[model samples]
Target chain A: MARASGEAVLTRAVRILAVFEPDRAEAGVAEIARLTGLHIATTSRLVAQLVELGLLSRLPSGRVGVGMRLWELGQRASPTLSLREAAMPFLEDLHAAIGHHVQLGVLDGTEVIFLERLSAPGSVVNFTRIAGRLPLHASSSGLVLLAHGSHDLQERVLASPLERLTPATVTDPRELRSLLARVRRDGVVITEGHIHPEATGAATPVRDRHGTVVAALGAVLPNDGRAGGVVAALRAAAHGIARAHTARTSDSH
Target chain B: MARASGEAVLTRAVRILAVFEPDRAEAGVAEIARLTGLHIATTSRLVAQLVELGLLSRLPSGRVGVGMRLWELGQRASPTLSLREAAMPFLEDLHAAIGHHVQLGVLDGTEVIFLERLSAPGSVVNFTRIAGRLPLHASSSGLVLLAHGSHDLQERVLASPLERLTPATVTDPRELRSLLARVRRDGVVITEGHIHPEATGAATPVRDRHGTVVAALGAVLPNDGRAGGVVAALRAAAHGIARAHTARTSDSH
Candidate 1:
């Protein structure tokens, strides 16, 4: 939608890229134009320019996907690289211990963006995917991050309408407030069937060197009493990740 | 460098982001200004704009680093995500078997950009970091990809001035040609001390469903004579990655 003659180039580029989502990673120019609400000619031209810059590439089906260059640039610019690296070993341990989905997620705005996730083919019907997002009020990782997030962020989320994903998703502002407080007090949260009818999410906060809660280490498992143990395992792994993160950051400094 | 009015806006934005590297991940406005060759005031304004967009964020020390949003955007668009996901299980297995730095890389332009790496703290002295880049001729992963790459790309690399990184780096055109030929024939490349004197890089090509060499799977280890076993492990892992990749692509189709 940034075809205005005087609009910033970066804004237009971001708009074009913003069209690609988890479910729709590749799209033809016509679909992209429709989704971005940009004129077909303008979208085509911008796409061409992006391809030239290696920010986008053509797929075998002639659809454009994010280019390797963007990935390289993101690799350089993505501030989460170190955090993800720090959390990887612990994530592996947690995955082996839990035998379900193990994920490391960071709070971005009011949502949790998963940086890494380890899963098996038939693991627990978990909705979490690497680079995917989930609402802070519903998902376990989101709950942990939001519990340790800024008051302003918490207030903003509370003020906004919490969209319901599944029937069990906690959407009431009052219920969510209490949930956030409990997550803070207990150092963990286990929400049952928020994303699916038969899955439960267990999460714990992961801190940085400065003791700032930087991420949420979490697991998605079948709804059962097993979440308590998963929470303990998650908390232990979170502690390890936080220690590793601190060590790496301090070393770099 | 693209500050000229009416120039591509994305180009200018890229220039600002291009200033950040693994070594220079966090930078002050003045340094970024110098690197991007933009006016100090202009750089600051653009930086502010990018920060507002969450493409960049200010660090605790008041310097700018890549924002989580950029990583998120990169995650969505980057073509390497599927490849990285497909290769992870095998990479972990290879790492456990070899106890060294295992990495997956893809050819971007003339360089090999590493997408993921698994390593222990005191593993081999690796110059390769996740999302880091190495010159095509100086890294084993690069050599494998280049060997299987197009004739045009091979010719272009040979024609270019190859900058030597270490004493073992092959810069001579005739020598490099033979090496590339050997890698194609042998289905693997073992480069010793091209990046660091104590490290040896052994790599093999990973194919997609259509049997296209889409990436290079490799490992960095001590420059001892024990490369044969590592090569065998790498080839097996590469085969696994290719199978997973093909399955994924065929599923998506």
Candidate 2:
């Protein structure tokens, strides 16, 4: 195969894998090929290779799904696991103290994939699920990630479609630009625009040893406009997580 | 390359990936070659290809580590994420109700690899880490998994070396046989071996729709003989997790 053809095959493989989301975990090869816009033969061959490599497994019913080996490899390779593990205690503290929905997310591509979430009983019905993705311009974690993200990433996101998630969402690129600027300047985001009208979120960046913002720690509270204390708690939690990360790094050495 | 050579290369790649752990995250090509008994030239070529494929990444300091792409793909391709997501709420409930270390583990080979754990403030210090492995004949989760595992797996584990972690660990194959029988009959395991002397763990199996034990949920309590309630909580949590798993599978259809 040509270099471009090999790259195309790899991209198709990724696309096939991407089709297996929280809603769709198992699919036939024809379904994958149709979803990925690839030839059925190519999809079948690639899926077979993946199964042979233990990246995918075939069920007893002959449907293909993501395999346990893939999960083991992913769990072992994920940097988010370390960060989430370190933040769990503090997140639990904040969740208990504030009695809201606490979340930890990391930037993956242009989206925020939630790593962990703790919800209080009778909290607002939040749609954010663990391992679920949200746009980088909608949620509070997305705002922190966008604010701390690279200039190129910011420009790319600004140029792309900014779908309106709610009536309060800032979909205009110019307004979003200004909002991201304010987030960078203020070091926090309090937004009611992401998914629910009755919920507001406060997010702050969790920095690594090199001072790079690696993740966002945030909490979702009811939109009663009493978010100042929540913001302070989130910032403190982020700081605690960062300190724990540093300590763990040093301790492991 | 010949077919056998291709298989060797693939196996070598897996070995290279296996060498990287939370403790040893980065290594040089020479170290990988030395560890896996592969030629330096072959190791270099394979590592370079893996880097190109985004399965491994080269650091600025001239060492290589598992890549973010691998992490992303792994996260995207694992059933473990779905399992963890379904189990987290009940795990949290158990942690709060028991105020001890709550763990979820799955049988991997003859060992049990912890998938998730929730610890309360001032919980007993245990060796269970995410992705960490423990022997099948030792810990409570291990005993549950081994007891419910396939006969082939049970025999293999029985034949393998059961390294004694503590003086209380059951290393005798004959005693282990009877203990596994008891665990199978009782549907739970309470073990004081393979970890701290001051901690005792009670574990129960979480079964899927096919009635196969897919995972184990356990709680580690301080060995002050106040473990009856904790064991009940663990069993209840395991049942809750199994119900959640069934609901998720049904909802996916």
Best by DockQ: 1
Per-residue CA lDDT of model 2 for A1-253, tens digit only, reads 4323333444555577677765677889999999989889878877887777777788888989886666666567565667887888888788878988999999878999888888755787677877777899999999999999999999999999999879988889999999999998999999974667988888999999899999999888888889887877888889999998878777766
Please tell me which predicted candidate would have the highest lDDT against the true structure: 1
| TM-scores for all predictions | 0.95, 0.87
By DockQ thresholds, what CAPRI class is model 1? Answer: medium
Q: Model 2: runs farther than 4 Å from truth?
A: A1-16, A37-42, A120-127, A159-161, A195-199, A222-229, B1-13, B39-42, B120-125, B159-161, B195-198, B208-212, B222-229
In terms of docking quality, model 2 is: acceptable
User: Candidate 1: lDDT of A165?
Assistant: 85
Q: Which pairs clash in the backbone of model 1?
A: A9-B9
Which portions of model 1 miss their true places by more than 4 Å?
A1-6, A60-62, B1-6, B60-62
